[model samples]
Target chain A: MILETKNLSIGYSAKNKSKILQSSLNLKLKSGNLVSLVGPNGVGKSTLLKTLCKLIRPIEGEICIKGESLESAESNALAMVLTQGIYAHGFTVFDVVSLGRYPYTNWIGKMTAHDVQIIENAMASVHIGHLAHQSAMQLSDGEKQRMMIAKALAQETPLIILDEPTSHLDLVNKIEIIHLLHQLSRQHSKAILMVTHELDLAIQNSDEMWIMSQEGIQMGCPEDLILDGRLQRLFQSNQIVFNQDQLHFQRNHLLSKPIWMKSNSDGLAEKLSFQLLQKLGYYLEAGYKDCQLELLSNQTWQITKNNSVFQFENLAGVQDFLRNN
Target chain B: MTIRILLLSILFVVLSLLSLLTGSVWISPSEIYEALTNPQLNVVNHFIFTQLRLSKTIAAIVVGMGLPISGLMMQTLYRNPLAGPFVLGISSGASLGVALFVFAGSSLLALSPWLLSLGLGFFAILGAFLVMLLVLTVSISIRNSASLLVVGIMVGSLSTALVSVMQYYSSPQLLQRFVVWTFGSLGGIHWNEIIVMTLVVSFSIVFSFGLMKSMNALMINEDYAKGLGIKVNYLKIKMIVLSSLMAGIITAYAGPIAFIGVAIPHLARNFIHTSDHRKTLPIVLLLGSNMMLICDLISQLPGGTTVLPINSVTALFGAPIVIWIVIKNRSFLNS
Candidate 1:
């Protein structure tokens, strides 16, 4: 195991008192594993990650890194990527990544040839080699995130921890980052733990999931956690319902009357109308019998019910028609 | 990089020579060289060279190098572009020390001039250290850099107000002394004062160099620096102490010369197009000394008996550069 925490209670300490957020956290992260820590905001997901990385002292219990006590492990043995934005005004991509070699460098921080090779390899692995000469401030948010990951990779530690690494990225970039992290964990045989809100992506890519809450932390493979309904219990909310099959969330509301959705040709409008009906809690029927939503080829939607028809030019109009009816 | 260093060195030499030759006495290069090499050659020229111009030149160099380097450290520690050596009100604290000594201490204890200066230096450092402690305490609660800067400015204004009250109740002679001190003169530093300034500034600069790596890491993010095994709190305290020491001592000796601390580092970064301290430090040092020498020479108003105040000259040159930097890199303020 690269990291093992036994009965760890993590939180802040005040004058002569301690506030424990979550306790009895017994977990082991082995090499070649990608674990996603999932929890709602303020459930101590960040606290756990910080304790694991030794940023903050755990209130109780022991954390061992590579069979050694976490306090005794050299910082160079673990690499971390934080969510804070880099304000390196005039630093190039390579200059930022080379900082990861700080632990091994001399007091002056002069890079050796071996260190240079490692930095280059890290940039190449993250597919930012072309941006090595570009200033870090000039890169997009996604590119800057990759550069930070490359810095962590250059550290060459056995374990890596990232805090909300995908929070600032767009949809495609978010998937790309998760995929890259998954590949890094497997290919490099490094234990990677990330605190993430991307539940669907984490479930799809993570080898294991750490579900944190007020009760405690539950660790298992994502599929197993889902099978045991642990994931749903972790994310339980009044207005939001987690869809197990679709691996997403939907609004929970009263079901409307069934609507028979029909179209002469299946296209974007038909698919969109079906989605809208589903969102409105109206079940779709195959044949047009009682009520029907017909999508025409000329960018028009017609809703017929009880021998009356309503027309809509757009999705918003369709939503209005459904609400009125 | 070598070429840039070479050009800056040449500029430094030119400014130093100009400073030496362009004093009120108007000694030529040959005469100045003769006096520098052999003090017995010309009594008047030798006295002018050794006593006046040389000490002033050294003072300018020390203040120049010390202020900007400390300023760079401050900027990195706070991760704010507007941060400078005086951001924590160290100079105002030092000014309060000077005021208390010149106005109150002089009346309470009838001391010699030497002892008075000694007491002034001691009180200045003490006042600065006290203010540093206060700033550090406030900074612990205030996490935002911008808010901390406002706190610093408020502290400075409070100190200045207190000093003004002291001046209002002081004797005419002591008030005149304090006002002249506020004008800030490089030419007033004695050789012994320069020697002390050199020792303190050198120690602080060397300590700053030791922190260069951590400063580079800190520029990215503080938590990132900690993850890299840097003792972040220790580094922060050390930087604050060193920066305060430099700012306080310079203010005690030369009065609070403004703008160089805030302006020179920006100039260095702009020239090199890099914030890497390893690359920027040397350039900042060279440019800082060069700029100070130029400012000092300008203040001398060569060939004229009258001299302009050093602070005015520095501000005249320094303020515009800072405004230009702000305009050029407006994004930095947002960041």
Candidate 2:
């Protein structure tokens, strides 16, 4: 095991009082695995990550890394990437990556040839070696996020923890970052834990999911948690719910009756029409009902309701007709 | 980078020579050489060179190097580009000390001039140390750098307000003396006071080099620095103490010299395009030294007798450079 928390309690403490965020959590992380910490906003996910990284003190219990108590373990043994914004004013990408060698360097932070090789390898692994000499401030948000991950990788610790590493990234960048993290965990044998709100991506990519809810934390394989219906406890809102079949969250929209939709093939338009109907609180099915939709050629939509046929040249017209009628 | 350093060092040497030569009575290089070789033979030239010009030049160099280093440390500590050596009101605290000394120690003015200045230095350091303690105490509970900067501004304002109240009731003579002190002077420092400033400023600058690695990590952010195993709070306190010591000591001797502290670091960063303290430290030191010498030489008005106050000269010379850098590299401050 790379990290194990026994009866760990995390929270904030003032001079005279302490506010407990979460308590009585037993969590274990092994090398060569990617764990996603999923929770609602304000669920103390960041506080838990902070406590685990020792940025803040744990309110109770022991956190051990590699069989040594966290309180006593040297900081070089662990590495973390925080969600805090960092602006690399004048530092190059290579200079920024070289900062990860802090724990290993001497008092003056002079890097040796071995350390340089590690930084090079880290940037190459993240596919950012081409931008080594580029100013960090000029990089795109996705590139900067990768550079931050490469920093953690260069730390050479057995475990790495990231807080929302994929936030503020575009769809392609998000997928690429998650995929890179998965590869790093498996190929490098580094136990990786990340806190993220991308539930669908987490479900598809993570080896284990640590679900933080109001009750407590539930840790298990994503499939196991889904099988036991533990993911439903994440939110109390009736408008949003976990969809077991799709392995993602869905809106609990009210439906009057099922609407049958027909298409020669499910192309972008059909998928979009189906999504629009579902979003408008209409249940979609294969069989016919009082309301029916057929995609004609030339990107037109035909809707028949109550034996009345209506045609829309665009999906917007279909949306307007459905929303009003 | 090496070439830049070499160029800056060469500029520093040239500026040092110019500062030494440009005085009321122009002493030729031959006379300067003669005065150095045989002090007893050329008493007047030797006196002007070693006793007057040399001490003042050393004063300018040390203060120049000290203030920028202090400012660089504070900027990194508070993560603010506008932060300076006196941002925590060390200069104001020194002013308060000097004000109190002038009003309360009027009787001591009858004694030797050396003793009076010594007493003033004592009180100034004491006041700065008191404020340092208060800031550190407040910092223990305040977690963020922005809050600490707010606290520092408050402390500075409090000290300035107190100094104002004292200034309001003082006699004209005492007021003039205090006001003149506020205008700041590099030439007023004699050998003994220059020795103290050199020791304090050089020691602080040297000691700061030891903090370069931790400071580099801190440039990323506090949490990141802590994750690197840096004792963040301890490092902050050390930076605070070191900067306060340099700013306080220089203020006590030179009377709140301005602009160099806040401007030189920016100049160095713009010139080199890096914030790594290990590299910037030397560049800032040399750049600061060069800047102060240039300011001092300009204040003397080269070839004229009357001298402008160092404070006004720094503001006049430095404000434009800072404005240009800010406009040219708009994002360098935050970067």
Candidate 3:
């Protein structure tokens, strides 16, 4: 392993006995593999990444890069080989990525021809070569995210760590980012670790995944996780049931009755109903009873003649009031 | 590199001549240069150039170059454009130290001039160092630049208040000397004082160069600097120490020249657009030295031989340049 943490306990040591941000978190990254860390909110994913990067001093464990203790390893030497790109503010796309060459730079901080070439190559790697000279403040959120990744690539570090890299990205941007990480792992041989919410993409792309749970962190392959039933346990939400074959969650039962308008249009109301459900994570399926829509969690729709009734396991009685009346 | 150094040295020489020739004495340029070169042949001319003109000329160049470089270091370390030795209470600290020394009267002044200067330099450096350290600590603890600024200004006002108390206790004879010192005279600094100024400024500049890379990283972000193996806390302390030392020594000799530190580096920035200090610092020294020499010369106004305070002269020239730059920066940011 190029980078590994041994029985690591992560968090601030400000007060006594407060070292349990995430405990028993042992992780290892080989020289050139992509790994993603996925967990629910407040599960210490960021804390784990920061711990591995040595940004915050971890409590009650050792982190080693290339068999050397992280703390004892020389910062300058570690800087050249193991680096993370962090966003400060308002640096140009070029200006920011150029900072990756700082370790090789002289006291004057002048970039040589070789350094400039590397920054260019890094920008090209992320397909942000056109925005090289543009200010980062001008770029769209997706573009800026890519620019940040370009900066990490420019560092040319063997081990790269990212925290919630695709938190606010759209679906397309999310896929592109995962692809970019995949490219770096395969083509560039960078040991990539990213914290993400996209479990499906991570499970497919990663060689290993570390499941950070309230009980403890467990490491295994995607297939191993599925075989062991940890995958189902990981995303344990009552609203939907996961299909192992298709890798999607489906509504467990019927919601309100499906509204039939000549049985011709389901697209428009389906979109509107889905959007309304998103507001409170509850939605009405189309059912028949004076064109009524009701809220449900394990939502499904049973279509009737013209009216609709939504179904819920427990809240179905109260939420189905409109149809009942 | 040798050529650049030589050019600056020559520029210093030319300014010295202009400083002597441009005054109310109105010595012709030829007579000025000839008299300046062959001083032994002309006793009266020697007194004018050596005792009066040369002393002031050297003091202006030294403090001008010294103060701004100190200011540049402060700005780089603190990562604030408004930061400088004087504006942020570093110079006021030195002024407070001087006020104490001047209030103590002739007995303290009777100590070896270097001892008195060192006495003044130490406390001034201590005062400035304390303020810089406080600003650094507050800035780090809060991680906010604007609040540190308000704190710095309050610190300066507090130092001013301390000096005022000292001024109240001083005798009229000592008071006059103190007031004269406060006016910031390049005119009274002797050859020995100039030597001290040169030695202190050169040494501080050399020491500050060692911190160039750290300062560059700091310019990007504090976290970036820390990540790059620079101990951010240690780098800040050393910058504060070096800046205070240079400001303290110059203040000891030249009595707190105003605006040189605050204004010249802005001009240097306009000249050298790069945020890199290796390029920025040398240019700051050159422009600062030039501005002080010109200010010293322009200070010879037509007031029936009533000379204006050099601080007032510097404030007059320096304030507008700084104001213009600030205004220009506002527009630059907006557009």
Give all TM-scores, in the order shown.
0.92, 0.92, 0.83
Residue A241's lDDT within candidate 1 is 82
- What's the distance in Å from true for residue B36, model 2? 3.8
Position B5, candidate 2: lDDT: 93
- Best-to-worst order by TM-score is 1, 2, 3
Residue by residue across B54-165, what tens digits does model 2's lDDT show?
9989999999999999889877876667667566666777777878888774676796767776777777777776786787687669756557768877998999899889
TM-score of model 2 vs. true structure: 0.92
Q: Least accurate stretch of 10 residues (summed lDDT) in model 3 chain B?
A: B326-335
Q: Under CAPRI classification, how is model 2 graded?
A: medium
* Regions of model 2 farther than 4 Å from truth: A262-273, A284-290, A295-301, A311-314, B86-88, B110-118, B129-158, B168-176, B325-335
The sequence of per-residue lDDT tens digits that candidate 1 reaches over residues A36-58 is: 99988898988888888778999
| Per-residue alpha-carbon lDDT of candidate 3 for residues A1-325, written as tens digits (9 for 90 to 100) | 7787898888777766575777776777886787777788887888777666667888888999888898986553232212233332334678767767777787667788998999999989889999886766568777767876776777677777777677677989988988888888889877888787787788778877888888778788777887798877887877666767567545554344333222222565455455433433333444435444432223443323244343433434333543444
DockQ of each two-chain model: 0.73, 0.68, 0.28
For each candidate in turn, the interface RMSD (Å) is: 0.9, 1.0, 4.6
Error at B245, model 2, angstroms: 0.7
lDDT at residue A307 of model 3 (Cα atoms):
44
Model 1 achieves a DockQ score of 0.73
